[model samples]
Target: MTPLFSFLVLSLKFLSADCKTEAGFCSCSCQKKELIMKAVSILTVLSAAVFGFFVGISFPVQITPQLQCGILPCSSGDAANYSFSGTSMIGILWSAFRNTNIQSNGTSENHAVTKPKGAEKLPPGLVVTESDLHMRRLWGSPKEDVATGKYLLALAVGYSEKANVNATVHKFSDEFDVVLFHYDGRTTEWDDLEWSKQAVHVSARKQTKWWFAKRFLHPSIVAPYEYIFLWDEDLGVDNFTAEEYVKVAMKHGLEISQPGLDSTRGKKTYEVTVRRNDAGEMHKTNEGGRCPDVHQRPCSGFVEVMAPVFSREAWTCVWHMIQNDLVHGWGLDFNFWRCVDNPEEQIGIVDAQYVSHHGVPTLISQGNGEQEGSSEKVRARQWAEMHTFRERISNAEKERGNSAAALEEYHP
Candidate 1:
C-alpha cells in the first residue's frame, strides 16, 4: 500500500477504538465503528485509482531518456545496449514527443531525421543524368572525357543553306562545340563537309529554331559552356570571328548580345541592329523618335532573336521564358531585358564583328505549293502568338498584385 493509504487505515482503526471507548452504548458504538471503517476503505480505493491513472499517462515521459539512449549512442555501458521497439504504444508516444521537442528547438538533428541521405548535397531543380555530346573512344584511355570547348554554337539549318552554314562554322575555331539542328530532316547529306563528322546533329522535319532550343538546350545540359551562340543558318560571317567577338563581349560585360547586321549587304529589320561604321567594337543604337525611353528596346537594351548570343547565367533565365507552343519566338526579343540587371549596358550590337542577314525563305517554302499564301499564314500566326504572350504577362502581373495585397491585409 501507498503511504497515504496506510495512514488512512491507521486513522480508521483509531476512530474505531474511540467509538468502543464510549460506555452505556457498546452495540451502537460498534455499528458506528464498522460504518466508519467501510467509508475509509472506499476512500483508499479511489485514491489508488487516481494514482494509477497519473502513472499510466506519464509512462512515455518516464521512458524518454531510455528512448534517447536507443536512438543516439550513449557513453554508459548499460544505456549503450538499450533497445527500443516502436511496435509498442509507449514507444510510439515517446517517438512523437521526441520529434516535437526537436522541431521546437529548431535543431539540425530534425532535418537529419526527416530528409533522405545525400539530399542536401544535390543542386536545386531537376538534375540531368545523361551524358553530353562529348565523344569517347572505344579502344584506349582518352586524355579527356568531355568537350574542351568553353563556348557553344548551335544553328538551325536546312540543306539548301549548306554553303552558308559551312562558312559560318569555319568562323568559329576549335574553342566552340558545334551543334546543328536540321529542320529539313536531311542530316546525312551534310556529310560531304569534313567538319560535319565532328559536329553534333539533331534532326526534325519543319521545326523552328525556338522549338529545337526549348526541347534540347536545357540549362543543365549546356551548363559547362560560358556562352551560347544561337544563330540562323543564312548569316554571312565574313567579318566575324568567334574569338574576337568573345573578347569584345567580355571586355564590355555583355550578357545578352548579337552581331550587328551589315546595312549595305543584306536584309535588315531593326535600325538598332544596323552596324555603325564609327563605333569601335560594340555600340548601343539610339532611335530619336521611335523609342520613348533611352533604356527601352528597338533602340537600346535589345538584340534580335536571329543571331543572339547569351551568357550562361542569362540563358538559364531565358530558357524558362520561352513558351513551348510559341515556336516562332515572336515578341521574345522585346522582353529579353527581364533576364538581365541593366540591359542597356549588358545588351548590345557587336559592331567590329558583324553579319549579313540573307533573309532566306527556307521554312516559308515548306508549305503546300502556294508560297505567298504560306508566308501570309506564317505572319498571321506570329501576330497571334505575340498577342497571347502579352495577355499572359498581364494576367500574371494582376495575380501577383492581388496576392501581395491579400498578404499585406492579413499581416496588418
Candidate 2:
C-alpha cells in the first residue's frame, strides 16, 4: 500500500474505535469532544433566547380597548358602542399608567383621578363651580334674571307683626331671595305670605344677626350669590329697588357698601351716610368736618351694620374677621376699609336707591320670655353687649395692629 492508502485506513480504524466504548452504547472522545459539544449547546441556547426577547418587544400584546366619559373612563357597556382610536387609546393608556403608578406608591387613585364630588369635570383654569351649592331657582327675581344683580337678602327677624315683614316681602320680593333668621320661638305668619314660599327660614331663639351670620352665612352657603345683605327686619325699602341698588353698586365698584340711610327715619346716622337725592352713586362728602381728609379712602365708605351689604369678596374677609363672642358687629364699620385696597374707590353709599332704617329694634322687642320685664331690659342688655363688642374690637385692633397694617398694604 502507498502512504495515502495507509493514512485512510488509519482514520477509519480510529473512527470505528471511537464509536465503540466500554459501556457499548455510543461514546466518543471522552474529554475533548464532550467539552466542545457542551460549549456549542450553550451558544445555541443563548442565541435563541435573544431572538425571542426581540420578537416579544416588537409585537407587544394589546389590552382590552376602552372609551372615556369626560375626564374618566366610560363603563363597559358604554365603551362597546365606540371603536378605539389611536389618540384616545394613547390617552386612556396614559391615564391607566398614571393610576398604576399612584397605586404602586400605596396611595388611593380616586383623589388624583376622579372628579370633585357633585362638580362637573371642568378643564384646568375654568372656574365654573363655587362651593358646590345646589342653587335654588326663583322666578321673576332680579337675582335670577339680571346678570349683575345676583344677590341674596338675609333678614334677622323675630316674633313681631308679620305684616311689617310682609310689606317688605311684597315690595322687594321680586328682586331678592329673602331669608329670615327667626330669633323668637313663637311662630309668625312669615310662611303664610304669597312670596314666603320663595324665602328661607332658619330658627334659633334670641340669637343676634351677627350670631346667625357667623353660624349660617358661611362662604360655602352663600357662594352662589354675588352679594349678602344681613339686614334688620325694620328696614323701610320704599325707595330702594334691588335692581337699581345692584346696578349702582356694581357701577361704582363698592365691595363693602349699603343703601344710604334715610335721614328722616334712621337713627345713629352719620352725616356723610345720610341720603341725598341729587348726589350720584359714589359719595365722599366731608360734611360737618367729620371726614377732614375727604380725599382719603374709607372716610366715605363707612356704613352702619344695621343695613350693610357685603360683596362676595368683601364678605370673605369680613367673615374671617367676625368674632364669635362679639355677636353685635359694633366696631366693624370702622374696620370695613381693611377689606378693600382702595376703599374710597370701592366703597360707597347708594344714594339714588336708598332705604329707611325704621330704627325699631324689632328683635330685642320680642324679649327673651325668661330674662326680661320689658323692652327696657332688652335695650340695656343690647347696650351692654354692644359696648363689650366695641371694647373687644379695640383690644383686637391693638393686639393685631402690625398684622393689620400689613394687610392694609396688600394690593388686592
Candidate 3:
C-alpha cells in the first residue's frame, strides 16, 4: 500500500491537474469532446472503406429478357423467329446455292438424286421441268440442284409487279413451302447462310402470274416436275402447308386442284373474259363454264393459275396438251386446265388459304429495271405477243374445255 497507493495518488492528481488546465483554455470541454469524437468516427469510416477495397462485399446483378429476339426469352443456340431488317435472304441463298453448288460446295446428295446417275441429271417422276432455264440466264458454270421433293408455287408479274407477287411469297413462307423465282438482276451473296449443310438444293416448280397464268409455256429445263404447280405468284396463302396441298388433292381424289384467286382491282375473284351464248351474248355461265354455273358452286374462271395445284395424274394429262400447242409463253395454265374434264377431275380451291396479288416492284425497283436496256421495240413486241397469246387462251377455253377437251381429242 505504501509504494502502489503513493504512485496511483500521484497519477490521479497529475490527470486532474492536466484536465483542469485544458478546461481553463477551452471552457466548452464537452463540445470539444464531441468534435474529437466525430473526427475519430470519420477516420474510422475512412479506414473501413480502405479495408473493404482489399476484402470486397458481393451484390447480385439483375438478369433480364431485355436482350432477346421477337419479345421472347430465348436461349443461346435455338433457331427462333426473327424480323428481317435487310434484303431477301431466300433469294440470296438460292442464287448462292446455284452458283457455288458445283464448285467449292457441290452437294453429293444432289449428285445422287437421279435413280440411274448415268441415265438423267435429276430425279425421276418430274411433271414439269424447266432444266433449260439455266441457259436463259447467262450462267456459264450453272449448277443443277435436284430438289428434295420441295416445289415452289410461284406467280411472276407482267409489265411490272402489278400482282404484289414478292409480298405474297414472303408471307407465304410462314405456311407453305414456296420458291419465289424472281427475274431481278441484283444477284446477292449468301455469306451468312449454311445452305450446303441442311437445305436441299431445290430445282422446284415455278409458276408466275405473267408466265404460267398469263403467258404460254416457255422452253424450260425443270418442266418435268411430276406435278407442276402453275399458278399466280401473287396469290395469298393463309395458314397452308405443302403437306396440306397434297392432303387436299389425295383426299378429294382430284387430278387438278384450282384454288380461289383474287382480282387485283376487286374484292372477290373477278371474271375478265366471259362465255357467250349461241346469240353471241355474254352469259353468266359460258359454254365452257368460264365462271361456275349456279347449279355448280360459285368458282373461279379458268384454273386460277394464281393458286392451281396440279397432281401427278393431272400433270400427265395436261402437260402434253400445252407442250404441243404452246402459242407463246403465256396462257398455258388456263389452256392446260381446259383439258381437265372428269368433274371427278378435281382442282382444290381453299379460299381460306389466301395470298395477295399485285406486289410492289421492290426487287425490280432496287435493280432499276435495267435488263441491259436491250430493245424497247423488241420488248413491246414480245409483250404484245404475250397478251395476244393470253386472249387466244381465254377464247379457246370458251369454246372447248382446254386440257379436258385436248386430252380427249388427243387420246381418242
Ranking by lDDT: 1, 2, 3
The TM-scores, one per candidate, come to: 0.67, 0.60, 0.38
For TM-score, candidate 1 versus 3, the one ahead is: 1
lDDT of 2 at 1: 31
Query: Candidate 2 residues 1-412, lDDT tens each?
Result: 3764565455456545644556644455554355556556765876898787656544434333677786798753345335332223333445554453323321222222333444435543453334412236566775564332257888888657466677666655354666788888644566567666656678888778888899888886678678888888887888877777788888878897888877787664566678877676656454454555565423465776888888988998888878787776656776787788887777778888887777776666566556557778767766676667556656767786643442211111
Global lDDT of each candidate: 0.77, 0.66, 0.40
Candidate 3 wrongly placed segments (more than 4 Å): 1-147, 150-180, 189-227, 230-233, 261-301, 316-329, 343-345, 359-412
RMSD of each candidate relative to the true structure: 11.6, 13.9, 26.1
Best by lDDT: 1
Higher-TM-score candidate among 2 and 3? 2
The window of 10 residues in a row where model 3 has the poorest summed lDDT is 274-283
* Best TM-score among the predictions, by candidate number: 1
Deviation in Å, model 2, residue 151 alpha carbon: 1.3
**Model 2's TM-score against the true structure:** 0.60
Query: Candidate 1 clashing pairs?
Result: none
Model 2: C-alpha RMSD to truth? 13.9
Could you tell me which 10 consecutive residues in candidate 2 have the lowest summed lDDT? 403-412
- For model 3 the TM-score comes to 0.38
